[model samples]
Target chain A: MSEALVDALNPALFWEYRQVLLRGLAFNAYVFFSAATVALIVGLAAALLRVNRAWPFRWIGTLHVEVFRNAPDYIMVIWVHFVLPLLLGKLIGQRVEFSPFASAVIALGFVYSGYFAETFRAGIQSIPQGHLDAGRACGMAESTILWRIILPQVVRRMLPEAVNQFVSLFKATTIVSLIAVPDLMYQVSMVTQQEMRPLPLYTGAAVTYFAVIYVVAGSVRGLSERWRNKIYA
Target chain B: MDAIPAIRVVDLRKNFGALEVLRGVSFDVHRGSVVSMIGASGSGKSTLLRCINRLETPSAGEVFIDGEPMGGPVTANGERKERPLSDINRMRRDLGMVFQQFNLWPHMTVIGNVIEAPLRVRRMKRKAAIALAEECLARVHLSEKGTEYPARLSGGQMQRVAIARALAMQPKAMLFDEPTSSLDPELTDEVLTVMRELAADGTTMIVVTHEMAFARDASDRVLFLHNGQIEEEGPPDQVFGAPKSERCRQFLSKKLQ
Candidate 1:
């Protein structure tokens, strides 16, 4: 609480970084939102593949999730950053440039999708065959069964895990800064470089990350509780 | 009116990896009457009911609903093709089934589970769906507990909700797979009251049961399956009192006592 310690920390400098913070928040939200949107579709599709007894489809989806989930997520982020731009740059030349933002979307969307697919697959299969039979017996088409009957159950049952995945995806955006999208961590790195205050800068990044994740998780919990009451009476 | 058979299952055979479960089972369930299938364990009574709905595909022979043969390969371009899931789903709406386990959607409320099929499957309007759900729930005497989820309900209440759910579909015929086996005696009576009420309303039923007393009292006809085939089938007075086959007689003697 000493004035000297507060002054030394230079909390006032955060005001100067206001625009940069806004930009960082926007980038973070962009990557998380877009990636999560694509990931939800991929996860549900892959989960459907894993559920049925069909061999080839199951294997393709299974292999995709396993190969990506087991390998370090950082590796995919790095690969997308370094390798994709060159390959894309060659194919399209300067006419269609693949920026770090685009790379971040694809990398996060595709990679996290594999993990969430497995999660959704587990969620879907946990529903009994009788439930499905009941749906069919009611004359529901397979598409209706998937969207209306199956996915609602999947989303309601898997809300916490899905929310957890979102938090993880938000954190994963930090890795995209390596490709120079200039996210939150990148901003913190700039402060560290300018002020040579590694601990405080990194500390700020950590606090920011925790705050974002806590807010997200808390919202999910709040929604889940209200939904649970309406469902269970 | 003893017209055309409502359901005709003919020479049904099922084999799973060389183990034959239903061996040449054949039968007829008349319209607007209760047909009780009774047997010891592994006698294929439940399997036969599943075959009628095509839930368990027969390895050989066929099942016919209203004299239309189902559960057999279709001739397509001079080759036989297995029936698609869509075709089977369409065919299944006329029939509804209840499982031994109740099989209610645990995540849904008692009323939500009842109304879900009609709303999601049939695309019934929300207001109409809830009204129909209320009617069905009232039939089963669980009208007040509509908003409660299955997990909060007792086993008997859950089974009644399962019945109400099936009834909400307004099925042409309903199938019961050991409905009373899982419940305590008191709970069993509660479900039977619903079943008896359905019967009085002239809804057709095919029940697979171990409750010999109910079968004797409630069924218009009793089928005694032994070793995957119908050993004896006749009126309850004959099957329960004067069984024809040794298997039927023995099973009745053991089960009835």
Candidate 2:
């Protein structure tokens, strides 16, 4: 709370380096949003596979969720960033390198997709069997029942957990910085090293993350408010 | 009436693992006639209705919808041939089934539930689907509640919305499975009133109910099921007033009291 401490960690110190941090934050946002969207779709697919009548598909889904969920996320990111290109290149007979953004998105998308698969499966199971029977009686095909009757209601039931997944995914973006992705943390480290102002730089980075998380939580709150009264949550 | 039956179940049987729910049940629902099946809780009344639409695939026997064979295994001399899922879905479209729980899609409005089938399965135009939905809602006396979600409705209103959803399909026959069992007496009356109106409109219907009065008054013929078989069946007057079987007599006595 002291003025000197506040002045020492001056806001002016950040102004010159603002562009680097802003760009990094924007990249982080892009990575998080794209990866989270992919994770949601992949997760729904995995959940469906688990609930599929065929045993083979169910085993595939189970294996996917167990493997990705149990593996450490940073290690997976490293594998995607460092090892996959080599494998791909060997297959294609060329030296292939993935841009860090694509690598990060794929890695985090896979990691979070496992969590999302469980969430989605639980939500789907919570829906009464009678609901599906009603759809069947209405003469809806299985795919139609899934899209119209099942998934929408599942989303309603899983909104809170889904928001949590997004937040987790957003935080997970920090791991990409380890792979030379010039995200917010990378920029913060660069600023701190050059200026020797670790306190101000790290605090600014923390504040940026806080702001991103706050926005996500706020948006979810707003969206759920509209549906809370009407939906059978 | 010696016309083609709207729904005909020939020697239908269903088993859940070791539990045989419906055993060699047979019935014909003549067009424009309301047939009510009354029975004890475990007497296979609901199972019989479900078998008609292949909701519960029969272990043996065939169902005919307007003279067309439904999705049971085609048996010739005790040899069975499997039916495709597409065939079952197609056959199911002509059969509208209302459940005891009124399983309307909670995420959609009452009108959305009503219009969904016609729009998706039949690929009806939006304008025409909406009009038909409104008409069906009107028939259920739920025109004003169409835009509201099912979660907002009373038990009776929810069941009415369910009936409207089925009616919107414009099915040849409607199946009711203990449609009022979950409702309180007052709400039960509301649903029964709508069902009575549907029956009067000559909608071919097979209702499974505990309401003896509804079975007697609304239905032309009543089947009393006991131990997974039709213990007695006749004109409601004969079945209710002059039951010949001992099991039917005991069952009716317990229900009436």
Candidate 3:
């Protein structure tokens, strides 16, 4: 039992494949950034649609939020990787194949955008009508009021909620390994297969993810809190 | 006085569903004249002030600013046509409105709130906008608070900042919608002093207020609204000293007590 525990705790094997494992972590970051960008842009659009005066736009936004928010992340990734390409190919009258990276990004991005849309919508609605009235009374156009007055306040109010969504998005990037994107978990499994030592490799992968998520999330939360305090002060 | 009044309201009526808030109310505010609108809660004084700026669209009737019609022209059937949004925005620029809630944008500094309109809507140069903002802030005695956010200021200070914000547009007339209703007595005095100074400077103002002292002392004329119509209107002295309407007298006795 002591020998087995020593083997499981050993860092030597995990360190030996540092280059490949580091590269895999970098891929996770790439996927996270790409998906986060998509989610933010699309989410804002959806939120605006949800709050629109017209009924059709509100219905479309509601549909988008319900469909994506309720869908499982793993199933979405698989569906985007496998089924979406076939559908696209048939519609376009040509063959279409998505790279694993593209599928992972698109699937995760769309799924997370639903949450972000709700967050943004809540933030937008929380603003007092008087603020909009003040803007309009000053002769500001509707678009100008949205950009200058509405969005700034919404962004600030939504920051903490958005950060939680972002952290969840970062963790969700690990599921990309199922589609062969070679993220950290994927590399760890490959290394475990080669070395035939499941204990240390899987343990190391879990610890690495824990440390990275903890530090990144902590720093981001701290920085945002400081910034918010300064503005509100 | 100029041939064109600063503001003209013709039979303005507003209805929310089945309930009528304002019923065929009409009045005129000449340039450089101070008109005070006084009423009990839900008497539609605020609604009348909001209609003049098209904030709450008048269900019927017309608002004219400096001889130019607001919103759209009326068709033969008495329905008001909708004007282009840009035209309405341009017309709104001539009127500066201050609200009971202050409604200063919380994220921006005092000066940022003041200069946002001139910089964006008027497309003024950055330096020119800042200069205008500073001058307006000075007029409200908040020149030192330019860099401070609204959350840090007292209610009185925040309302003053709101006043400076409106003043930066250099409007032809200013509208006050219960500007002191939200303030404490001490805070109310500070705001009223600034408003009194504006009145003394000959700023065209339509103030909807419950401060009878301000209505009596600061106004060239006073109007009392009751049940969506002007119940009484005359010189401040006559309106306050010997109001013709029994409703106006009752309202005054209750408020002034």
TM-scores, each model vs. reference: 0.92, 0.96, 0.97
Summing lDDT over every window of 10 consecutive residues in candidate 1 chain A, give the lowest-scoring window: A7-16
Q: What lDDT does model 2 reach?
A: 0.90
Judged by lDDT, which candidate is best?
3
Interface RMSD of each: 2.6, 1.4, 1.1
* Deviation of model 2 at A113, angstroms: 0.4
For model 3 chain A, the run of ten residues with the poorest summed lDDT = A224-233
Give the Å shift of residue B68 in candidate 3.
Answer: 0.8
Worst lDDT run of 10 residues, candidate 1 chain B, spans B71-80
lDDT tens readout by residue for model 3, B205-247 = 9999989999999999999999999999999889989999999
Give the per-residue lDDT of model 3 (tens digit) for A153-200: 898889999988998999999999999999999999999889999887
Residue B90 local lDDT, model 3: 91
- Residue B224 C-alpha lDDT in model 2: 91
lDDT of 2 by residue, A1-233 (tens): 89989876786877779999999999898999889988988998999999889999999999999988997889999999999999999999999999988999999999899999999999999999999998888778989998999989888888888888788888889878999889989998888889988887888788879987998798887888688658653
Q: How would you order the candidates by TM-score, starting with the best?
A: 3, 2, 1
Model 2 error, position A215 (Å): 2.8
Best by TM-score: 3
Stretches > 4 Å off in candidate 3:
A231-233, B74-80
The pairs that clash in candidate 3 are none
